[model samples]
Target: MNRLTLCAAALAATALGAPALARAEDGRWQIKLLGSGVLPDGRIDGVKTDLIGLPAGSRTRADDNVVPTMAIEFYATPNLSIETICCLTQHKVDGAGALAGARIVDHVLILPATLTLKYHVDAGPIRPYVGLGPSLFVIMGEKPGATAKALGASRVTMSNELGLVLQGGVDIPVGDGGLGINFDAKKYFVDTIARFTTTAGVKALETRHKLDPWVISGGVYFSF
Candidate 1:
């Protein structure tokens, strides 16, 4: 009789453990840190040509840039979640030949923040995900060489920006209790539609730029 009771208890334990293991495989929370390299086009048209001139109407170029970002996510369901990310980056513009001449055109800080809705696909220990969202950007700095006191060809204060962000990535599980490695990519669809204010007046200019930048990074994720 005792042997039969022991066998029944063993069966019940296995049943309970199986369901708990299944739940752990279902839902989770994640976080990521991004290291990115970017390139910018620093050109302004429709302004006073006497300040800096390349051709009649030409654009300026800047060097490649590097930036860092961070994000947090909550898994509302096993395959769905919401996320937000923030980044800091710098930009510059310079003279091309006898035109504007050589100088560190601008030095400023750029902050782009975004919110996204994500969907994940289960593929063994590795899961892949994709998302879409909107973003807000603020650019503060100046151009390379102007005598005007405000920016004087060295800075521009502000820009009101509207943009879109698209993202995709994967996660790999490492150990127990929701520890893993994460990877993701993001793109910002934006344009420079800003007006510079000087003693002359407000002038509208369009700055050409790159839209998609590659991001390869790793961080930690915790499950609740």
Candidate 2:
């Protein structure tokens, strides 16, 4: 089976045998295993370039990715907690407007780490929570695509990003243990700069990209 299927099956089995797992109490720790699909609503702006044949008004955009994710939570009280979430995701950059049908950058990996302070409602078997925090986005492993090479571009790099994160979710208890399912949604406001190098005697291209992505995820949570 694929990774998503396997994860879902494992969660199902865990829930079926929840009586054997440890329960959640005050000041307890919870860890989660999640499979997520990341959809980015990104836009590229301030695209200043001097490539010979490309238009000065050319624009860019980014594509989505699906990956596995993880999170950890520490409950300071029955209704309050601190949580950290992380994921390693890959994205592709494409040309837009005047540079349509061209691939500007490929196989770029982004690592986003987020920490939030959450307040949960004590609603017996079902708990709802809201959180707000900061995220650190690390951009790396960027490779120049065909369009870049055709324009004599040799290397590409993206600057590290910092953003704000807003989150909301619900948790439902399974059986008698603290094993349950958590469904979450998060919004991020991130901005970064991309630099591209050209041939030995040519100047580089620098552009700004804004990534305001909404991340939705569901997973199995174990508390102790």
Candidate 3:
């Protein structure tokens, strides 16, 4: 079985043994599918426009791209949990005004996985929690067009990313052991080490890009 399934089984076994686990479901595992949105930023390094008499516009856009995410969380204690999310992301790059036709779409798979420790506060039927953790992220994509002259026919590439994460959430219990609803928000301090190449004998293009985005998600949680 997968790690999530294993976690769930462990939680179930623990719940059967301890009254705290049975009542609070302290070690339960949670899974969620989150609809997410990505904010993209751009930067061009090591290339000077005005100094080299070149008119290169290296500006980032504030376009929000929607993506889908899958997550698995495990509660070590009733008040503490750790989670990971995977987002399938795609970005469109427009080559300024004159070179608008030279646009490209980059398909990125982003995994913002975190290992957080949370502290929950009980408030009647509502539970609120806050967490801080370390995160690792990976970003990868394919070349916009394989036969494009500029890209030189590079098909696919990948990046290694690392970051920190901060998160908070609230849970609204429906009925006794029936179902629960959850709402959470997270922010990732992500940085990517990107390396790519093209078929035009270009070996490698390496750069480190940084970005931070806030994510909001809601889902249902069922406890037995």
- In candidate 2, list every pair of residues with a backbone clash: none
lDDT of 2: 0.79
Ranking by lDDT: 2, 1, 3
- The best candidate in terms of TM-score: 2
**Over 4 Å off, model 2:** 1-26, 48-57, 201-203
Q: Show pairs that collide, candidate 3.
A: none
Better of 1 and 3 by lDDT: 1
Evaluated against the true structure, the overall lDDT of model 1 is 0.56
Task: State the TM-score for model 3.
Answer: 0.67
Over 100-196, each residue of candidate 3 has an lDDT whose tens digit, in order, gives 4444334554545555667889787898988887766655544543223355436445456667888888888888874778888888777554444
Better of 1 and 2 by TM-score: 2
RMSD of each candidate?
14.9, 6.9, 6.5
Alpha carbon lDDT of residue 200, candidate 3?
Answer: 52
Candidate 2's TM-score: 0.84
Residues 1-224 of candidate 1: C-alpha lDDT, one tens digit per residue: 34234323433332333333334346554656556665554445334324333355344556667665566666667788777666656666565544454443456555565677789898887899999887776665544344223343322444547788788888887887677777777776765543334545543232444323333445655555
Q: CA shift at 213, candidate 2, in angstroms? A: 1.5
TM-scores of the models, in the given order?
Answer: 0.67, 0.84, 0.67
